[model samples]
Target: MEPFALTVALPIFGLIALFCLPSRIANRRAKLVRNLVTTVVGVECLFALSLTVGLAVKGVPSQSIKLIEVWRDLGLNLDVFVDGAASLMLMLVSFVGFVVSRFSIRFLDGERLQGRYFRWLGFTIGAVSLMVVAGNLLLFFLAWVATSFGLHQLLLHYRHRAAAHRAAWTKFAISRFGDALLIGALALTYYAFGTFELTELFSRARDLATSASQVTASHVAIGWLLVLGAVTKSAQFPFHTWLPDTMETPTPVSALMHAGIVNAGGYLIIRMSPLVALAPTAMISLAVIGAFTACFAGVVMMTQTSVKRSLAYSTIAQMGFMMLQCGCGAFSAAMLHILAHSLYKAHAFLGSGSVVSQALATTGAKSPQPSPHLSLAYLLGAAAISAFAYAAVSSAFDVNVVTKPGGVILALVVCLALTTWGWRLLSVGEITTMLLGMTGISGLCLAYTASYLAVSHWLQATTPLFAIPPTPRFVLLAIALAFCALFWLHFVVIRRVRPNWLNSLRVHAANGFYIDTVYRRLLTPLARS
Candidate 1:
């Protein structure tokens, strides 16, 4: 009856029904069951959408309802918590589920094990919804682990492939390690503070901030430990190998991870961002790793022949951007990127598949699942970047080595990726049309990246980041003027020049320099080894 019940209960019930359905759909009865199951999922998605609309109109804090209370002696009560944050995440999950569902209508038109797929789909959306709305650490952690295991199951839904099974095992194995770390972190918090309550922890944090004691600094070690748990789960560097490998699953599931599940990392980073700030070093570690992942992954994106692998790297890059923001002490900036990127990335990946599918038609062969590029050096590069991201994203106490983080500097990293990509595409893509499409997309990315500065500006005006104000307006103004220079050249000089100088400059900016070669060189030895 409660919102949380509808949010949590209905999906769990659907999962039970789905799990009960036979694996092989041979009979009329089985087909009927599968259809009914899909219909139910559809209903759940619609309900979530309606809830989102209401939230937009009235905007209630993320709303959650707890169903049961066990272990009352231990101060453990199962509860749901919702606010703007949870609502946003739930709404994103719901919509992504529905889109994937719509896609499955055509994507899995006559597929076997339809029931298994649909059921897990419902369960995933539900678990994520529960995750967003969970009230306390116990509830959130339960949902977190459930979703993690559920993803493992979903990854292996197709029964035959050794690779699929292996990917599933990898997810499960990594998630279990992450689970242990998460539980350990929670245990420390509980032992130190005396409760497993989220609100209580926040209050405790505020009190500690006001206190003057070495013990308070010790509190930060626990916070970083918790951050480690979140990073591993979210596929931040060092642990990111599993993500692109996850492509062994169906396309829709791939979409779910990129557009929805993988986003859980961003959600956790934001949800606990306040705590992360307590250890600024850890927060910057997040940013450094994030920025490098973006830059590194983007370069790797160039090498991949398969569209899917390229897109996977793009997702990695997006995750990196979110981490960079976290590192830079731009919480809302990161949050906004997460939301915008999810929707657009979903559409882009879907569109990319369609384009690739057309290429498959030319061969008249059973369309190969796009090749998964497992580059050795890239993995190690990612590992190094992960180390940097870790330091960059940390909640820093002092500025020293923490400032350097890893991979490379953010400005250099991005300049390199964009420059390399733009130039390569310009050289390869033959027509004016292709260049336009390419530049438009690149510009959109640049806009997103630059917009952060503006938001960072406003955020600084309103709140203090490490007791320092935002960058001076003169810098931002200069950045803006630089862009204006290009705009001016585009309209005035370019037409007269006859060569479209603006287009050429766009080509130049896109090259991101010859940075890709350097990355390749850095990675070659690792790749071979």
Candidate 2:
């Protein structure tokens, strides 16, 4: 067996063994199962480590390695092909799985559901392992679906806890919605290009010999749809709210999803980047959404009280940053951040549980808030992101990047100065200052999105056919100056919005639109009928 196959196969085998083992021996059974699980997971981790070593030594050597046949005559097969990105993700998944398993041992000490829990856990690992290495889109899709199933089960691991059960189903339902979108995209992929091989599809997509299903189904359309698949899976933008709420699952599950599987979306974008490049709109969309989501989630994190929820929001924000990197053509750097953050985030969540567990074990009840220094540190860290986003976007201010030197700088100063100053005001109970900070953050989000869209279009030199003709430079300058006036006018609205502005923003934010409400209104009665 190929080295990669060993990594993928071990998890499958472990899950099989876990489920097959009888559940009646009490402590004797748990201990035996624990030992066996440790051994299997340990072996899996080694295989991943070996692949990583091999990659580092030899650098992403791809070979055609057959793993299974999902179909016979229809040209469907499960092939695991190793690339630099896939190897890295597998290592991350396996490493996290090892840690979570170790934690599970101590945390789940006498839990009767250990067998089922490990089974789902192993299955999730197996699916993600296959997913990251899948050479074909169909195989990748299968693994994607399998990964979702594992997540669904993992979320429901504490079936007795209604919140746990509810979170599991919520995750399942949201994931299913994405699944439908992905299935459609896969169908379109196959229909557009006859073969499901992801590599071949990208190679042929630019010069399609096949007819499109619709005249309007151009390169941009397919790219947009595929990106929709990516965003939904990766949990970008509008697709994001689901991820933050998913913390109802055990902390371990959150770690795995955010640190490992969430990055899968990024991996997909990178793997299919060639095809994505052909669809500039998709890239730009990602850039804009990623930018806003990163900033939005990061800011929201500051408001959160739950430690896990804070991390969850942080994951959302960071994922947006990764997407922005991808949009801006800084893939290698994005991968580095993903790698570093995965370790840190997993450690943070696991450590949190350990702290909570220890606290309860000793003095009982909830632990106190983090020191004021820590709180201030988090706020300052958030304020500084306006600068980081500014810097990252500033490095290559293309149309594809969402941050403009001007816009990003403005947002940065406005957000940081306002937020920091607002903190001072809030310290002295200045509601006006607090509201100003709130409005500043909101404005920054919109500005970030606009920058994202412009950058995306810039990357591919996409010009809107209906765009207004450009005026003379001096004429444009006059308009630009006029816009400066308009910007302040908008700021004035933000200024006057008052202390209770968040309450109004809440209505917009809560309904997640009036957009969500509109969507519900449109979809709800139709579904009921």
The TM-score values for the models, in the order shown, are 0.68, 0.67
lDDT (tens digit, per residue) of candidate 2 on 1-529: 3755556665645554443444454234666666666666777778877876775565444454766777876567777766556666777877887888788777777777776666666677767777877878888888888888878878877667755654555456557787887787778777767777755665575444233342246455566766777787787776665576566676677778888888877877766665565565567667667767765665456556677777877888788877766664445545655777799888888888567677667874433344556546645644554445444444544433223322332333335544444343334334675466545554554565454543333222111111111222353244334434433333333333434665564444434343234334444443333
The TM-score measured for candidate 1 stands at 0.68
lDDT (10s digit) by residue, model 1, range 1-529 = 2553355446535643454445455223445644664566566666666665565566453344555676677667676554556555666776777787777656766776665676676667667767776667777788888788668778987757766665566666667888887787777767777776665665566565554373354467666776777777777665666676667787888888888888887777676654555665676566556655665565455445677777777787778777766666656566667778889878876676678567777755332222123222323333344344333433232223223322123333334334333433343324784456355544544564456444433233122223312323343344334433433343233124335654554454344334434434444453333
What lDDT score goes with residue 517 in model 2?
Answer: 41
Provide the clash count, candidate 1. Answer: 44
- Name the runs in model 1 displaced over 4 angstroms: 1-42, 49-66, 212-218, 357-529
- Total residue pair clashes for candidate 2: 8
